[model samples]
Every structure is written in structure tokens, then in C-alpha cells.
Target: MVISGPRGTKDMLPESSCRWHYVEQMVRDLCRLYAYQEIRTPIFEHTELFLRGIGETTDVVSKEMYTFTDKGKRSITLRPENTASVVRSFLENKLYAEPQPVKLYYMGPMFRYDRPQAGRLRQFHQFGIEAIGAAGPTIDAEIILLATDFFQKLGLNELTLLINSVGCPQCRPIYRDKLQAFLHDKLDGLCEDCQSRFERNPMRILDCKNENCQTLSHGAPHMTECLCDECQGQFLGLQTLLQAAGITFTLDPRLVRGLDYYTKTAFEIQYPPLGAQSAICGGGRYDGLVEECGGQPTPGIGFAIGLERVLLALEKQQLLPDFKTGIDVYIAPIGDKGKTLAFQLLHQLRRSGLSCDMDMMNRSIKAQLKRANKYPARYVIIIGDEEVDQEKVMVKNMDSGEQCMLALQDVQSMIAGEMDN
Candidate 1:
């Protein structure tokens, strides 16, 4: 029987992988410009870390985690999201001691157990960043700017920036009470999930996607309307900073993120044409996550972009960038002596920083030429027994169908010249 890969998983083949490489490089280059370094964490972690960091009441911990017990009877889970693990790394690695606020970025696969959809998968990749130990609206605005700049870099200009304030520990309780009281008589109208959320987290009811829950949530007290003095100032300051930065946004009162750790400023960016699943990315200030993860109280904010969804949006907009899928050089060897000489030249060209490939199948000259064109090599170096005896090789340019004769010693220089262009 033939075995197939699991559902909700995808393979990045050669053609598709080149685009991934381009996207990854763009992320690294852009983050470098913003003075943010990269960080990588383990694929899985102790289950309690997420349980404590992300609230137990949230859907991630309650339903979607890929968790199992090990031989030592310790429960472990594949990371559904990375913010909590990053906080753990911050505390454990003592990143907080070095700087006031450490700026970092990451790109990797994340696992979650959920029903697969168009752009969402059980296994997906994310590009995210975090700014820790800084509390205030300036960093918050900068985060928004970085996210927009990245999208703009990818030619994603048709986007909606939605912002809101979820209040802090001090004032959320009051609004939670008001929200619960407001939702009290309307409990029966909520979905099963929203009904359960009412007892543990009433604010999440506003974020529910169910149409019935949405109607029942209409005219409900918004968190922006109930912000305390400090939260009020920070929210206003964030708006002012964004406006000063020339970034336009809309205030979305019902934009409560799914995570329980989020506090204060919350935001999301969406491609309006995609409709219900329009959000390309979302994040917010989790000022309380560090403390919740056993560190001295630190303020933090960041966002994670779902790469698959971003690619989907790019496809919809016809904005995906073109990628070159060919090597720099292809070597075709004629006979025993030529094969030996070809190996030496291939190593030399590669060591000098040129992408080089050679025919291993020992096909006829005509077949070798065909294979070289498949990689669509920019330059093909042919070393036949006669050419080896003459101490010369034929260099063919695949694009313009141009050919030139070069001495054996000048082959590397010829390919190096091609690289400069």
C-alpha cells in the first residue's frame, strides 16, 4: 500500500520553495532595517507553559493543541502559537537583563489541531516579531508601522488596519461585569461556544463569528467606551502616533483577539476583498504575558502573519513576485577524462560562489544539452575529450543562444563574469 502525507499538511516543492526563499529573505532584510534580530525556539514545549501563558479557557488550550505524554509521563505539546514560547525564552535565557526592550523576529512552522480550511491548515508557517520590556504607545505604533511596511513591500496596498483597546487588568473587570450584565439576558441567543465564553471570558463573545452571536452582541458596551484613565491615554497616544506616522486605520470596537493574555491595545490587518476570512494577520499588546510566564512584569506587543494566507491574498491580487528557478552553471562532460576534469571545475566554480550542477547520468551529448536547458542554466560549460585534449571548453549562453570557446583555466572567470550581471 502507498502511504500519503497527512491531511492539512503541504509540501513546498522546488518551484514553490523558491518563492518561500524570496519571502523569507525579504523578512530578514526588512527586519534588519528595523533593527530587529531573529530568534528561533523549539517546535514543542511543556504543556503547562501554554496552559499558563495562554489562558486555559481559550480555544487553543481547550481544544486545538496537539498534546501527548512522553515516556517519562511528562505532557508535551506542539506549539500552536509562538508568543508564549518566546516569553519563556525571554525569561529562561535572561534576554530581559541585557536590554530594556529586546526586538526580535522569527519564521517557522506552527502546529495546531483544527479543521483545515482554504488558507488555514493543521500545519502552517508564520512570520512574527515581538518587542518586550517596553510599555507605551510609541513602540505600539512602530509595530503597526513595521507590519504595514512589510505588506507594502510585497505590493499589498489594499489592506484595512483595525485598532482597539482591550483595557488593562484594572479596568477590564468593570467592563467585563458590564459586558456580562449586558449579555446576561441574551445568553440563550449566543452560540454554544460563546455561551461557554460568557462565564469565563465575556469579551470574547463580541469576537464570535457566528451570525446569531453577532446580532445579539449588537449595541453591547464596547471596551473603548469603558477605558480607564491610563488605558485611555495610551489608546489616544497610539492613535496620535499612528497618524503622525502617516498610517491610516479604523477603530474596530469588536476586534478582541482570541487569546486571553492580550491587554490594552489590540490590532489586526485585513485584505477587505477576502470577506469573512479576510484577516491576513493579527496581534496586540500582551503587557501581562511576561508576568504570567514567571518574569518580572514586562510590557510586550507583536504580530504574526500567516504566510499561506498572505500568499493566497497575493494570488488574488496577482501580486506574487517572479522568482528565477535556474542554476548559474551546468557542466556537461564527454568521456572519462572529461568527466574527471568536469568534477574539478564544478567544485572550483561552486567554491567561488556560483550555483553549479553537472550531469550524473552520462547521457549522450544531445540529451545532456536538453537536461541543461531544463535547469535552464544561464551558462553551460561543455568539456568533451577533444576539448580536454585541446585544453579548451565550449561555453553556451542558454538565453541568447550565444556560444564562446574558452581555455580550461578561464572557465571559472567566464562564469564569475556572468554572476556579476
Candidate 2:
């Protein structure tokens, strides 16, 4: 009998893992430069956390959650996203007692039971950052700028930033009622999901990907129109901050994100190369989330970039890194006695932080040379009893086709100097 990994999961071989490391390293470095510390939360949490924090009306809680009952009779779930968990941790740990606006970043797998599609899986990784306890519109603008900087660092220049403000608690209710009234008459013409969403979360219907829903939402109520004085002031302040920071963005009134905690500013970054699934990063200001998780009323803003989607975008645009660091040197032995010496040298070179490989299957000298040629090594070492007895090794320059005998102790220094050049 044989068993395979569950569908929608991928095995990351070395070639692909190299690319993953490149992206992860970039994320870590950028976050560090921006003074954002790393935060990690449990993979699973009480089901109520998501339901209350993410909102029962949102698709993430309504349909996508992977929930199960543990032996203790508690409803536990593998988190579909990180914001709620982070907020929960913040409240539980009382990080609010620290600095005014705590900056944190996280990277890990998030589970969801959605239909598998290109760059969409039941299990996927996300690189996200959260800035908590800052109510200033500049915080929102800075988060947006940070996201842009991250994409720019990865050489993704064709991405577009679309931003909007969904108003706050004081104004959203008025807009929701107006949107519901408009959609109520057109309910019969909408998709089943949109129809259901219209009653529960009318703002989400504006974000539906269904062509008919998109058309039906035309001329529908815009959140900008119903924003109260305070919300309007906040939106203008956000625009001012973005302008002051020299970050260009387009105001999109219809761009409502599909989450419950979001209030005021919401934004998405789209990479044109990925076709329909072009959004590479998305996030918004969930100023009420901290209070929703039982903490003091704290304002927070964040964004999450889908690692798989970013890789796909990079692949489409031919922006993937070289990914082939290759071996530093390949060792070839000419005889049985030479083979034993080659093994010893291989171990020593590896311990010295040099990537070295030897022919373990006893291939002929010619075959070994051919295999070594396949690698991107700078030098090839030929080991035999004559050179071993002489306390020297034959080092062949792979690119120049030049060979020289060098003392064993001097080989490391020679390679280091050549690499520096």
C-alpha cells in the first residue's frame, strides 16, 4: 500500500527551496531594517477567536475555516489567517503596555479549506506585518509604504497600489443600510453567494469576482458618499500622509476587502503578470480589532503577501533569482587509494564551509570529470597517491583549464583569494 500527501500540498525540492529562502530572507531583512520584530502564534486556536474577531459574516469564518472538535470537547481550528491570532496574542500578552505602536512581523503557514487553484492551496505561507496601537493616519500610510518598499526590493515594478477608506463604525452602518436597500431589489439577478452576502455583508458583494455581481454593483452606493465628518477627515489625512511620503496611490471607492475587522483604510497591490489572480499583497486598517479581542480599544494596520502568489508573479515576469549557488569544488580520485584520501579531503573542505562533493559510486575518472563539469564549481581537485604522498593536491581551474599542485594547507587560502577576485 502507498500513501501520498493530501491534495493542494506541495513538496519543495532543493531547487524550489532556494527561491523560498531568497524571499524569506528578503522579508526578514526588510522587517529588521524597519524595526519590526518577529511574532509567532500557535497554529491552532479556539474556534471562537476567529468567529468573533474575523466576523461570522466573512467568508474566512463562514466557509473557509478548517475546524474540528478536540478530545477535550473544545472547538479548535487551524487558523486561516494571522491577524486575529496576532491581535489575540497582543491582548493576552498585554503588549499594549510596552510602546505606543508595537511593530511586529510574522511568516508561516495558514490553513484554509478553499477550492485549489493556481497559487491557492489548502495550506500556504504568508509574510505579514502588523502595527498596533497607533491611531494616526500616518501609520496607515507608513504600512502602505512599507509594503511598496518590500515589493520594490524584490524587483517587482509593475505592481499597482489601489487604496480606499471604508469609513469607521460611526459611518459604515449608514452605508451598509443604503447598499442593502439597493441590492435588495436586484437580489434575484445576483449569484447565490452575492445574494447571501448582500444581507450579511453587503460591502463584500462589491468585491465579488462574478461578472454578473460586478455588473449589478454598478452605480451602487459608494462608501465615500456616506462617510461622516470624522471619517472624511481621517480619509483626507491618510491621503495627505501618502502624498507627504511620496507614495502614489489611486483612490478606489469600490475596493472593499473581505474581512470584518477592517475599518477606514483598505488597500491591495496587484501584479499584472498573474492574470485574474493578480493581487500580490493586501491589507487594511482594523482599528477595532484589538478591542474586539478583549483588549483596550487599540488601532492597528497590517498587510499580508501571499508567498506562493509572489513566486508565481516573479516566475511570470522572469524575476526569479539565480538560485544556483552550485558547489565550490568537486573532488575526483584516480585510484582506490586515491578514493580514500579524497573522502578525507572532502570532509575537511566541507567542515571548512566549502561545498565539496566526491564520486561515491566509484565512477571512472573520465565519468567523474564529466559529472563535475555539470556543477558550477570554481575549482576541481584531482586526488591520487602521488600527490597525496607529496603533501600536495592538483587543483584544476574549471574555467581556465589550468592545473597546478598546491600544498594542502594553502588550498583553502588560495580558493578564498580567487573567490574574492
Candidate 3:
């Protein structure tokens, strides 16, 4: 039997790993600048956290969750997303008691049993930030600014920020009923998913990706048109705040998020160049999630960026930087005794905060040179029996093809000085 990784998963090989590191580091640095601390939640959590916080009606909770029964017959699930678990942690850990608002960011893998496509995967990674206990629209603007800055840092210029209001409990029901009546008449031409959602979550019908569903639901009632006075005020405040911050955005009345917990001020940042996978980041104000997750009546706003999709978008625009984890120096051993000295040199080079590698498979001198050239080593050292006896080594510049004899004690300073130059 042939064994392989499960489908809808990727290995993230060497070339891509460099890009991953660049993106992750940029996110971390920017989060720090924005005064957002890092928070890590478990990879798996009780199945109910998502079921309650993400809403049982949404696709994530209804179908995509990867759930299983443990030995104790308790239902456990690989986290589909981090928001629910983070909220659970905030409540269980009593983070609410300490601060007025908690600004936190996280980057990690999330598992879902969805169809594999250009950007969609069964197991994917996300970089997200959640601002909790903040009801002001300024927090919403700040979150959007963080996302825009991240994309700008990656050189993704051709992107759009779409904003909307899904309305709160006071008005969502009115829109739901109005939408249900409007969709009911058109149910004969609608897809099965839309038909099911028509009653449970009529707002989601506008968000459906199915071409047929989209076409049939064109005349459906918009959420923005039905928002209550308070939700409308909040939406207007969000737009004003965004404008004040010089963040350009479009009012997309059709942008209802696919989560039940979201209320008022929903948005998605899309890479218009990438067709179906254009949406690299999406989220909204889940003002009710905290209360739903057994916390205080604290409102929250956040967004999540799909790491795989972000990379794909970067590739489409040719904006991805080259990733090279090249070596700083390569050491070649001429013979067995010299090999012992080479090992010692390798250890010392590593301790000196320089990346160094040596031929470990006993390859021929020519083979070792070939391997050294493949890496981005600045200098190559040849340690033979004669050099060991003289307490010196022959250093060759990999790029200039220049050679110089230097004492063993000068190796560290030599490399450091070259680095400075």
C-alpha cells in the first residue's frame, strides 16, 4: 500500500517556506507596532465552542468542521478558525477583568473538511487579529488599517476593501423575514443550499458563491436597507472613521458575512485580480459572540487572512520576494584528521552566529565544492593536514574566486568584518 498525506493539504516545501517566513514576520512586526499582543490557543477545542460562537447555521459550523469523538465520548474538533477558541480563552482565563479592551493577534493552521481549490484547502493557515470589548467604530477602522498595511507591506497594491452592515438582533430578524418572503417566491429556480438558507439565514443567500444562486437572488432584499436605527448609526460611524483614517472602501450592501455571530459593520478585503479566490481576508463585528460564548456583553471586531490565499495573490501579482536561506560559510575537509578540525570549526562558526555547513557524507573534494556552490555561502574554507599543523586555513571567496591564508584565530573576525562590509 502506498502511503501519502491526506488530500487538500500541502507540504510547503523549501522555496515556499521562505515566503511564509517573510509574511509571518511582517505580520508579527506590524502587530507589535499596532500594540496588539500575541495569543495562542489550542489547535483543538471542545466542539461546542464553534457550534455556539460561529453559529450552527453557517457553513463553517454546519458542514466544514472536522469533529471526532474521543475515548471519553466527548466531541472534540480541530479548530476551524481561532476566533471562537480565542473568545473562550478570554472568558475562561478572565482576560476581561484586567483590561477595557484586549487587542490580540495569532497565526496558525486551521482545519476544515472543505473542497480543495486554488485558495481553499482542508487544512490552511490564517493570520488574524481580534479586538475585544471595543464597541467604537474606531476599532473597526484600526482593524482595517492593519490589514491594508499588511497587504501594502507585501506589495499587493491591487486590492479592494468592502464594507457592509448585517444589522443587529433588533433589525436582522426583520431583514430575515423580508428576505425569506422574497426568496420563497424564487425558490423554484434556486439551488438546494440557497433554499435551505432562505429560511435559516436568508442574508447568506446573497453571499453564496453558486453562480445560479447569485443570479436568482439578485433582487433579494439587502441587509443595509433594513438595518435598525442603532445599527445604521454604527455603520455610518464606521464609514466616517474609515474616511477620517484615509482608508478607502466601498459600501457593499451585499457583503453579509457567513457567521451568525456577526452584527453591524462587516467587511472583506479582496484581491480583485485573483478571480474566485479574490478574498484573501474577511471578517466582521461579532458583537454577540462574547455573550454567546458565556462572557460579558462585550462587543468585538476582527478579521482573518488566509495564508495560502495571500501567497497565491502575491504570486499572481508577481510581488512575492525570492526566499533564500543561504549559508554564510562552507568548510571543506581534505582528509580524516582535517575532518575532525572541520567539525570543530563548524561548531565554532555556529556559536559565532553564522550559518555554516560541512560535507558530512565523506564526498570527494570536488563533490564538496559543487555542494558548497549550490548554497549562498560567502566564503569557503579548506582545512587540510598542513593547514592544521600551521594553525591556519585557506579561505576562498565564493563569489570573487579569491583566496587568502588566515590564522585560525582570525576566522571569526574575518567573517565578521566581511559581513560588515
Candidate 4:
């Protein structure tokens, strides 16, 4: 029986994988420049970690998680997001004992049982970073700058930075009460999800995507309106820091990121060209999460970029730079002797830092040349009985249509020189 891949999964073929590699390299380089080290955590974790860290009121925990029970009777869940897992690692590994603030970046697949859309998938990839143990607004502004710098480097210039101050624990309760009071009369008209969130997490009701819920929430109390002294100061400080860095942003009071852990400095980077699901990256400060995850009280902030959505935006805007995955040389061997020589030269050239390939199918000279062209080799080396015996090979520059005979030992140097030019 033939079986296909699961729904909401995509195979990245050769042509498209080049673009993914380019993006991954860019993310790595940016992380290096920012002094953020890479961190990898398990793809699955104890289901309780997410249930508590992400808050059971959130959609990811309530409706979207890939949860199951293992043979050991322990609840296991494929991670829908990494921040919770990262925090769990921090607590379990005693990373908090070493540094004042640890900065880490991660790139991997995340699973969710959501309905698939243009860029949203059941199993999607994310590139994200977390800076734990720092409470200052400078770190917050810097994280935003890091995200903006990455997109700018990729030529995603049309992105909009929407920033907001989701009141911290000190202030959110006040706003929650006010919001609940405002929505008390409108409960019957609200969606089932919003109705449940109304009593549990009224702030999340404002984040509902339902049009009717949105309309009902239009005049509801905003988090900024209730920011206490500390939260207010941090909010203003974040704005000042970002402006001092010459980064412009719009204040989006309605931007309550779909996470329970976020506190203050919520922001999203949106690309208008991608339509409704335009947020390619979103994150904020979570000063209380470390303590929530069984660690000492530590301040933290982070953001995650949806790779699939970012690629879609890059494609829509024609921003991807040229990525060539072609080999530097293709060796077409005509006979057994020539094949032996080609194999030796292939390894030698590779050791010399050149990408080279040889035909193993034993095709005719004409067929070998055709395969070389299809391989899109920059240079083709013709090895035959006569050339093998003469200790010379004919090298043809596919681009310039220039051909010349070169000593076997000189071929590597010739290609190296041409590459340098």
C-alpha cells in the first residue's frame, strides 16, 4: 500500500532546501553577532510542563497540543513551542547557577494540531531566542532590534513593528477585573472560547480571532490603561531605548500575543504582503516564568520566527538572493581506466576545497557530457583513454565555452584560481 506524508507536513525538495539553508545560515550569523549561543532541547517533554508554563487557558494547551500517554503511563507531548521547554531545561540543568542572564537561540520543528492554512501547519519550524535573567528594558529593545535586523538583512523592508506593553502581574489583575466587568453583559453574545476565557483569562478574550468576539472586545479595557508604576516605567523605558536606536514602531494596544507567560513589551513583526496571518515573529518579556517553572525568580524575554511564514514572505516579495547549489566540476569518464582516474581526481579536487562529481553509470561520452550539463557543473573535465595515457585532460568552461588541455596535477590549481577570480 502506498502511503503519503501526514497532513500539514511538507517535503523540502533540493531547489527549495537551498533557500532554507541560506536562511538558517543568516540566523546563525546574526545569533553569533548578538552573542547568543545555540541551545537544543528535546522535541517532546512532559505534558505538565506546557500545561503549567503555557497556562491551561491558552489555545496551545487547551486545543492545539499533540498529547498522549506513553507505555510508562507518563503523559508525553510533542512540543508546540520551545520557550517552555527552554525554561524547563534551565531549571533542570542548573544553568541559573552560572550566569546572571543566559542568552540562547534554537531552531527546530514544533507540532500543533491546528487547522492548516497558507503558512500555518500542524508541524511547523521555528527559529527563536531566549534571554533569561535580565529584567532591563534594554534587553527587550535589543531583542526587537535583533529581529528587525534579521529581516532587514533578508531585504524584508516592508515589515511593520507593532509594539505593546502587556501589563505585568502587578497590573494585569486590575485590567482583568475591569475587562471582565465590561464584558459581563456581552458574555452571551461572545464565542464559546471567549466566554470560557472571560472568567479564566479575560485578557485572552481580546486576542480572539472571531469577528464577533473582536467586535465585542473593541471598547474593552486595554492593558496599557492599567499599567502600574513598575510596568509603566519599563514600558516607557523600552520605547525610549528603541527610539534611541532609531527603530520606529507603532503602538498596538490590541496586540495581546497568544501566550500566557508574556508580561510587558509584547511586540510582533508583521509583513503586510502575507495577508491575515502576517505576523512572522512575535515575543515579549516573561519576568515571572523562570520561577513558575520551578526555578529561582528570574526575568526573561524572547521571540520566535515562523520559518514557513518567513519563507512565504520572502517569496512574495522576491527578496531571496541567488543561491547556487551547483558543483564546481563534473568529471565525465569514458572507459574503465578513465573512470579510475576520474575517481582519484574527484577526491583530490574535493580535498583541495572544490566541489566535484563523477559519473558512475558508465554512460557513453556524449551521454556523460549531457549528464554534466544537467548537473549544471561550472567546469567539465573530459577523461578518455588517450587523455588518460597522455597525463592530460580537456577541461571545458561551461559558461564561456572555452576548452583547453591541462596536466592532471594542475587542474585543481586552475579551478582554485578561477574561483578566486
Q: How far out, in Å, is residue 122 in model 2? A: 1.2
Clash pairs, model 4 backbone:
none
Candidate 3 segments exceeding 4 Å error: 207-220
Which stretches of model 2 miss by more than 4 angstroms?
A: 208-217
Which pairs clash in the backbone of model 1? none
Model 4 Cα RMSD, 1 decimal: 2.1
What is the TM-score of candidate 4?
Answer: 0.93
The C-alpha local distance difference test score for the whole of candidate 3 amounts to 0.89
Against the reference, the lDDT scores of all candidates come to 0.91, 0.89, 0.89, 0.91
- What TM-score would every model get versus the actual structure? 0.93, 0.93, 0.94, 0.93
Per residue, candidate 2 scores C-alpha lDDT tens digits across 198-231 of 7777888888889999998899989999999877
RMSD versus native structure for model 2: 2.0
Per-residue lDDT, model 3, residue 378, is: 86
Residue pairs with colliding backbones in model 3 are none
CA shift of 136, model 4, Å? 1.8
lDDT of each residue in 1-421, candidate 1, tens digit only = 9988888999999878877887888899999999999999999999999999988978889999999999999999999999999999999999998877899999999998999888879999999999998989999999999999999998888899999999999999999999999999999989999899898878889989899999999999999989999999999999999999999999999888889899999999998777666888899999999999988989999999988888888888888777776898999998888999899989988998889999899888789889989877888888998889998889988898898889988888877776688
